[model samples]
Target chain A: MRTIAFAVALALAAGLPAAAFAQDEGPSTAEVDAVIEAAFPGLDEEWAARLAPDETMEQCNASANVPSDAVFEEIRARAAGTIVYPDDGVLVGSWENGEKLAQSGYGMRFSDYPPRRENGGNCYACHQLTPQEVSYGTLGPSLMGYGKLRDYSEEAVKAAYEKVYNPHMAFPCSMMPRFGTNGVLTIDQIKDIVALLMDPASPVNR
Target chain B: MQKLMTRKISTVALAGALAAGLALAAAAPPAGAQTDEETQRGLERFRQMLREDPWANPALLDADRGELLWTTAAGPKNATLEDCDLGLGPGVVDGAFAQLPRYFEDAGRVMDVETRILWCMQELQGVDVAAYVKRPHPSGGQPVKDVGAIATWVANRSEGEPFAPVLDDAAGRATVAMGEALFNRRSGPFDFSCATCHSASGQRIRLQELPHLSQPEEAQVAIAEWPAYRVSSTHVMTMQHRMYDCYWQMRMPQLEMGSEASVALIAYLVDKAAGGEIAAPGIKR
Candidate 1:
């Protein structure tokens, strides 16, 4: 599949007039879409709504996730609009729960259901939180010294909270989940996650 | 009329064709003769062993239960997981076990199937998973009794498929690259990343051979088998949970599940095993 795709891409890049390579068919959007759509045989209206592309998804799809500056700005602006900060403005919560949440990759799976269930941050899935947890991921930057490096300033702390709440607020097309904005987590949960990342006493800071 | 015309014009751009081309390339099989290769034979043998040698493979029982749990719905929503997105689409568990560790902008990081499912459970189904997220996967020398059953069920859906991540996009590339760098970046008392053991071409810890996840075959073998049932622990563990345990073994602070770094590492592994087959719900130590 890789070879064929590359060959087709090369053909298209070479300006094969679209007719030459047209004979050599590839996986079409419609085809992939059909396969994807068939996967969900019976979905409710709410569940089905998630199947289609949203605004951010459309932009990522159109640009192949390598959007230009203008598109980046647009995505960021749109994602930012989706962010809803806590009404109380307190972004800091207990670091202990945050620590547990960071370490855990549980919750939010098919097994965790019946809805109305409290969600977890599962931050450690893609990051090294503290010096103690050795089984961390290296997909994102090592935040071991997040607070120590930044002096744990009020702004940085708040920003960390919001970033976890909605990573798009910082990096427009971040791979991080919008914990707060998408309702994956609540204001208190966000605060706890921030504490896990930024509190000096927290293992992350140590 | 103008709006419709503009939409038509934009849709006709050559870029979409190019993007589609790239996506197709990203979806292709690996370079070598992966088609001719028979990696699944070993897995099949292992599976056969499970039935013949009960002592050798206790996970078989856990996996059987997992299969049942998968079809059963016990959550507050009282809805079975007939529909769940595993990157490819909803309920499309086939071939998805290996494609994860891909980028998901909604989460602002890369996510394996497990973490992504966790998000779906919370947002779509309204499951309060706060408590489980706090407790570790049950693994105290007994079979992981709780989640392992469900993990076995979900992982069993995509057995003997190819391992591929959708890292064709820049975000995907960046995520994998970040994961690579993190794998090499050492810190803490031991000053180790994932590379300390799994990076070297041929390294091992005690009895197990630690495959070099940076390379192809080894990466595929390691990443393809996850969300497995651990006989000794008697627990089912997702890759995310496995990673947490690994960190604990390293004596480092626990990593946050579904964090940017975790997703990035997943992307790195998936990218490394780009062409390998997907074989989940395997029996583990």
Candidate 2:
């Protein structure tokens, strides 16, 4: 066991890809799950469920976020099914409210428990939505002139709504959160974010 | 030399300006745009200035307190940790921090600095280990616990030493493997693994850069700076606290302090950070 472990470490140190490590050599999935369970003792059911991986998360973890073609399609389909459109069929809402949601990263964290206010898209955390927001992060691509570049068509508006709702619907293994599907953002909030992206009057197009 | 001094002075002035700009940016909504490159450069310069001035770091006060805790006899057995073995026989502290998270024969498990310290506190001083484990990390403006302070002082002793943790033993290797697995495994409501934010190079969460832990160059710099003084929180954060907080932010359940899982992750990180210089109790934003 010592020799094998040493060899595994040696292989890892020799520039072998992490994905190449033999799955059996590492702690089994059950072992890791047990560790996680024991780590967070006495957590309520709601928070406990958050710790366990959903089917989509399990698949993502199993493949290290690089799913096979079949699994990728399945994840996308599952994500698409979870998207709930607004009752009024309005894909766009007030961009002003959307701007606040994008700017505020105020939901779902442990400190945010017994939430004081509505959830946010936390859009600026990843994307550059407006040219004036210099403090934006570079995790996602710049969305400056998003609607303007797309000509603010009806199709563009609907597509923006879907992307904000569940980025996995279009791009599996996307780094963006599943805002609408995961209940981090409501349908109306998602619409507002879409407006922030696709509204002609929004600063993003300016 | 004169030109260099002039340039440094100008850079300091620029950093101050950018800091003020950042404060205003935080207070108001989007207005005038500063390019990402410029903002990052200014932040880096600010960090460098803080690092250069050792006196500016508030963590040193905690390190002094830790030294006091280490020498003074207090617990039930009325023992000082002066004779505690940190993988270098009893009473040896210099350079020990850089070579830790290794397999300990006596304990029969791989232990990091904090875990080993807790063990000694239990055995030598007859302190209740469970109590320390159960205590919550101090919030902003609050001092770190005794263990954290001691960890800071211990880590500070290894300043400028290269990290050379030898994970050649069977237990050590297994722990590293477990850590590697845990780092990559995506769980939780956000579907995040450590890899989610960390595997990629040059990624950020709202202007804060995330290191690519899998890559050695990035891993080295990242791990070497731990037991850092967080400017945002106004406190010295130990590695254990850092791990616990990351789990919290990931929306995972609380990661119990000194758990086997936490040890494994640190072991993996230390292994990856081999040869990185220890600059513990380092300052950070």
TM-score of chain A of each: 0.81, 0.87
Model 1 chain B: which ten-residue window has the lowest total lDDT? B33-42
Give the per-residue lDDT digits (tens) of candidate 2, residues A30-107: 777887787778889998898787888888787877899999999999989988888889999989999999999887
In candidate 1, stretches whose alpha carbon ends up further than 4 angstroms from where it belongs are A1-26, A62-64, A115-117, B1-285
Model 2 lDDT per residue over B180-262, tens place: 98888776766677887887899888789889998889998999978988867868899999999898777777788888889
What is the DockQ of the complex in model 2? 0.43
CA shift of A66, model 1, Å: 2.6
lDDT (10s digit) by residue, model 1, range A1-102: 999999988888875543244522323343333433443335566544444545665555444446789989987887677766668877778889998778
In angstroms, give how far residue A144 of model 1 lies from its true place.
1.2
Off by over 4 Å in 2: A1-24, B1-46
DockQ of each candidate relative to the true complex = 0.01, 0.43
The Cα error of candidate 2 at residue A49, in Å, is 0.7
Which of the numbered candidates is closest to the native, going by highest TM-score?
2
Q: How far off is residue B108 in model 2, in Å?
A: 2.2
